[model samples]
Target: MPSHPSPPARSAVVVPYAPDAPPPQLAPLAGPDRPGGPAVPERWNAVDRSAHAPHLVAVPGADATEWIAAALVTARPGTSYLKIVDALGDVPAAVGAVLETARRRGLAQVKWEGWTTTAEEATALGFTPLRTPPGAEGPDSGYIRRLYGAEPAAPPYYAQTTHFTCGAVTALVARAHAGALPGEALDRDAELTLWRAATNFPACEPVGLGVAVHRAWPSAPVTVFLDTEDPVLLDHLPEAEQEWRAALQRLSRADAERSGTPVDPRRLSLPEIRAALDRGGHVLLLVSLATLQGFDVPHWILCHGTVPGAVVVDDPWAHAPAGDTWVDAHLLPVPDASLDAMSVLSPARFRGAVHIAPASTGP
Candidate 1:
């Protein structure tokens, strides 16, 4: 896949609040049209309209008085992830209300990018700082609070250096889990080398990525699953690009064979991926980021475990601030249904996956 252009950063719209007001009582705002509520800002409205399942939290004055703070939030469509997009007045109180609401709603995680609370305040409220990806600067970084008590051990996170290198990062994450590479070794030098070895440069194919992993650690077992029945990109690309893609696939297969890695013709299902994680294997999944971030691009994510109703993922893109904090993309919970939809690329309608295990595990 060609490198995707980075999306423009969304600036946080900060609404000024009254300097002095009585401490407020936090509650869920009934709807956008609740009577006697604080007026919703235009940015909040925009986010609400665009979000998957939007909700509002309000900090009303004590004794059923007046609205002191309000915020717009939504569950990331197809996932149990909740994001706090915009707020007005008493941000901390409003944030607390949102967190409570999310807990009640059974959301797995909560992320707030433009938080007004200090580190101490956020920690006191159960939020851990989120990390920003390397070489990317943003002000929207905030905290991530895991609602579920199940915290499975996960491989070290390696943020992609470029938009197109997520596949390589996914591979590195898998390698870290397999004990072939240390998580701290995923620096620029390592990333570039792995990118060159795994990617068909600009387009990282499943087979090619597996081949690179096998070559790097022959002891580790790698299984590459390609959706041969579905000619996803081939059906949509221009003739020249299609031919280029075909050549790349052919080369990737050849490399896999030469490197002694196993290439299987299979389309993985949700259960299979979950089972793989259960069996102590990490998965490098090719998914569409549009499902999560509203950007239509081929992306890669690492699956390490499964909760009761969601898959735990380590996304390579750190769109948050707080610079390498706890919730940047660590153990994110995506509902099974949403993961299924994201697994199949749009229009292209094909799925790709790579399962890797440590040397001791047999295929």
Candidate 2:
């Protein structure tokens, strides 16, 4: 867990909410200023609401002996890593209860993004600093406790500099994780370069992105799954724009064929996505941001791990103004059934995905 900037200044103000099972995901600890505008930096207004909205939540302990004040860090629905920024309590039960409530409601996973809690009490509550990404453990700083038994391994987070390059960024992250590209080299240049290689002008068609990854490292074994042969990701474009983009997609399909990148016509089911990951593969999943985010548009995310009934994905579009950070994007859980429905890319309801596996061995 790399040290993120500490959450905004905390006041003891606690908002009243359901103390027992369910809790509102948005009630952030700080951001006295709500509405955050667009893409602003260091502003927590996106999640904050109203001038008097209390950032802290008081969850009564199981025994009802004490009321624990917790800062609900990331308030996302089923497909997010719900985070509780911090909680003031002798025991972790207060925040722990929040986590349990989130899980019961089918949030993919949860994190205790510490702000005020001490290491002794945090570790005692099954909260731990992340090591794969270098949690840099100890009480001296904010250590996260990821709830749910999902693995902590995450490809380093890379925020998409441009709005439409999520597919490119996602493929690059897969390349970095599979040792095809230096993780440190995943900068703006790399992002645009890959997008230029893979994009059908701007939107990343599945075949084009797959071809780019396979071309970057042939041994990485890229396979794309798209249900339709007709040009996709061009529905919103006008007639002439759709014509050119559709041509580019056909060319991409040709490229994939030449590069030996298999393009399966069948839709990649959620179980297949999980199976690829279980075999130690990374997936660039095409999804509509409507269910995950408020907007309805085609987006790409990297699927790297799986929990009990869900698959974990690392999304690249980190909206800073929305009070979203890499912590929000990094390896969050998405339930199996929900992921199936969210992965669709068009009005046609066909979904897309690219599976990249480790280099094959044995002649």
What TM-score would each prediction reach against the true structure?
Answer: 0.76, 0.77
**Leading candidate by lDDT:** 1
Candidate 1, RMSD to the unseen true structure: 9.5
| Each model's total of backbone clashes | 11, 1
Off by over 4 Å in 2: 1-57, 60-68, 88-93, 103-108, 114-124, 130-144, 150-152, 361-363
Q: Model 1: per-residue lDDT, tens digit, 277-306?
A: 888888899888776767777888999888
In candidate 1, where is summed lDDT lowest over 10 consecutive residues?
A: 4-13
Residue 133, model 1, lDDT: 43
With a 3 Å backbone cut-off (N, CA, C), the pairs that clash in candidate 2 are 1-135
**Model 2: number of backbone collisions:** 1
Point out where model 1 deviates above 4 Å. 1-56, 63-65, 69-75, 85-93, 113-115, 129-136, 139-142, 229-236, 318-328, 346-348
What would the per-residue lDDT of candidate 2 be over residues 272-358, giving only the tens digit for each residue?
A: 888888878988999887766667888999999888888888888755444445555666778887788888766888888898887
